[model samples]
Target: MSVLYHAVRTPVRWAFRLLTDLRVEGLHHVPSGGPFLLLPNHQSILDPLLIQSICPRKIHSMTKSTQFTQPAFRVVLAGLGAFPVRRYRVDPQTVRVLLRLLDEGQGVCVYPEGERSWDGALQPFRRGTLRVALRAGVPIIPVGISGTYDLMPRWLKRPRPGAPVSLRFGEPMCLGAIRDRSTRDRRLPEFERQLVREISRLASVPISRETRERLDAGSASPSGEGGS
Candidate 1:
C-alpha cells in the first residue's frame, strides 16, 4: 500500500464504524496479492471509498472524469492511484490503463452498473464490463455493499449517519477460456447476466447473524436506540 492509501484508509474505516454499524464479511475471498477485477454494486458515492477502505491492497479505480476537473481533488485522487474514465462513452485509453494495471499484478475496482442506483436496488450490469475481465484473464471479485443507499441516498443532502451497513465480498470467479466465435454473440449476454445474478444475491445477504443480533439489541434498547 502507498503512504497516501494508508493515510486515508485509517480515517475512512474509523468514520464508517463510528457513523454506522458497519460489518464486513468474505474478506478472505480476495487474494493476499494479485491482479484481479473488483466489481461492486454502486449505491452512493461512498461505495468506492468504502471498498478501498477495507481492501488490504492498493486498489486502482476508474472514477468519473468530471471528478478530476478540480485541480486539488485531481491531485488527491491521482495520489491514491485513481484514473478517470468518461462515462457513457467509449474511452479506449481507460480500458488500456485498466488492463495494464491488471497485467502488472494490481487490483482495480469497477462498478458494473455504470451508475449508482436511484432506488437502492441493484441495477442491470452495463454491457462490456465482463468483456474487460475476460480479456484480462483475471479472477473477478464481486462485492455487495448494502445500507449505503438508505444512509446516503441520492436524494439526501448528506449521509444520515447511524444506519447499519454491510460490505460482503464474494468468492473470486474465473471466466474460463472464451469459446470460439461461432456462438459467442449469443453467449456473451448470458455470461454477464449470470454474474449480475451473483452480485444481486450477495447484496441481499446480510453481513451475518451477529450483525442482525447487534441491530436487534440496539433497537431493543430502553432508550429506543435506532439508526438515524
Candidate 2:
C-alpha cells in the first residue's frame, strides 16, 4: 500500500511544488526506522497533502469519519492509506488501529491542533494525539506549515494560484522523556503545549505570545474542535 501511495504521490508533489513555491527544512530529523508520529500545525485543508508530499516516509493519515460516508470517498481514502476518525469523540478503536500501524513501523500523521485554523494561526494541541503517541511509545516529530490558509481558506472553493507555502520539520521528540504513568493525564497538556511552541518556532511567520495564549484558550473549549 505504501509503495503504491509513493508512486501516486510523486507527480502530485511536483505539481504542488510547481504551483506553490513550497520549501521544506529539517528533513534530516525524520528517523530512518521505528514507529514515529508526524504532528503538524493545521492551517488549512491542504496542510495534510503538503506534508504527505514532502515526507519520504509513507504516512498513515486519519481523516474525518464523515468523509467516509460516501463510498467513493472511502475507497479513495483507503487507497491513500487514510483511516476514519470520529471528531470530538475519543475512539479507542481508532487508537488501537493506529497503534497497530505504529507497531508495524509505519509513520502516522496527526494534526495536534485537531482541525484547520480559520485564521491560519497555530491552535492548541489536542490531548487525543498525545494519548496515542504516549500509548504507542512513538517519537513525535513537530511540523510547522505556513501560507496554506491564504492559498485555500475556508471561504474559497479552490486554491489561489501562485501562493507561497513553507514546511518545517522540527527535531523529533522522544516519548520516553514525556512518559509518566503517575501523571499521564497532566503530561498530555504540557506535552501538547511544548509541541505547539516548537511548531511556532519553526513557522516562516512569527506568532505572538498573546495570540498563542488565545489559541490555547480557544482550543480548551469543545466547539470548533476538528477531527484527526
Candidate 3:
C-alpha cells in the first residue's frame, strides 16, 4: 500500500463508518499474506469501496477502462494500485496485468458479475473471471455484500445515509484439476455454479433450507471444489 493510498482511505473509511451501519463477518477467512483473488457479488457502484473499507489488507481491483479517462481520478486510482479493464470483451493486456499482479503476491478484487445487478439479485460469474483465477493459481475468497443495493441503486444520485450494510467472507476455494480432468473447458460449468453458490450462502438471502443444502453439497465436492 502506498502512503497516498492510506492517506486517502482514512477519511473515506471514516465517512463510511459514520454514514452506514456497516458490519463485517468472517474476516479471518481472508489470508494475511500472499496473492489471493477476491470474488464479490456486485450490487452497487459502492461495492468495491465498501469491501475495501473493512478489509485488513489493501485491494487492487480492476476498474472499467473508461473510469481512467478523468485526469484527476486517474492519479488517485493509480496510487491505489487499480488497473483498467475493457469490460464486455476480452482484453489480453488486462489479463496479463491481473495475472502478473497475482503472481507478484498482491490482492486483487474482481466482481464475477462483471457489472452491478439492476434487480439486486446475484448474477452469474463471467467465464473470463473464473479462467483468470484458475490461470493465476491462487485461492479465491468469495465476498457477499448485503444491503448496499437499497442504499444506492443504479438510478440513485447519492447514497442514502444510515442504511445498514454487511460484508461476509467465505472460506477459500481451491479448485485444483478436478478428478484429473486435464481440460478447463469441462470444469467451467461446475466451477461457475460452485462460486455462485458460495456467494449466495454467504449473502444469507431467503432460500429454502433444502435448496440451500443441495447447493452447498454440490459445491463442497472435493473433486470439483471451487476456489478458482
Top TM-score: which candidate number? 2
Residue 32 CA displacement from its true place in model 3, Å: 0.9
212: Cα error in model 2, Å: 4.3
lDDT comparing candidate 2 with the true structure: 0.74
Which residue pairs does candidate 1 place in steric collision? none
Better of 1 and 2 by TM-score: 2
Residue-wise C-alpha lDDT for candidate 1, range 1-228, written one tens digit per residue: 778888998899899999999999999988887788888888888888888888888889888889999999999998888899887567777888888898799999988777777777676554456556655678889888898987898777799998889999999988753534424334555566566667778888322343234334432112111010
Q: What range of 10 consecutive residues in model 2 has the weakest lDDT sum?
A: 218-227
Compared with the true structure, the alpha-carbon lDDT of candidate 3 equals 0.76
lDDT of 3 by residue, 1-228 (tens): 789878867777787788889888989988899888889888788887887767788899888888799989899888877888887566788878887888798889998777777777776556667766666678889989888887898778899988888899999987652323345545655776777778887875533354345445553222332221
Sort the predicted structures by TM-score, highest score first: 2, 3, 1
Q: Which stretches of candidate 1 lie over 4 Å from their true place?
A: 177-186, 205-228
Clash count per candidate: 0, 0, 1
lDDT of 2 by residue, 79-161 (tens): 78888889757676677778789889988998776777767666656666666676567788888888887889866888996
Candidate 1, residue 119: how far the Cα is off, in Å: 0.7
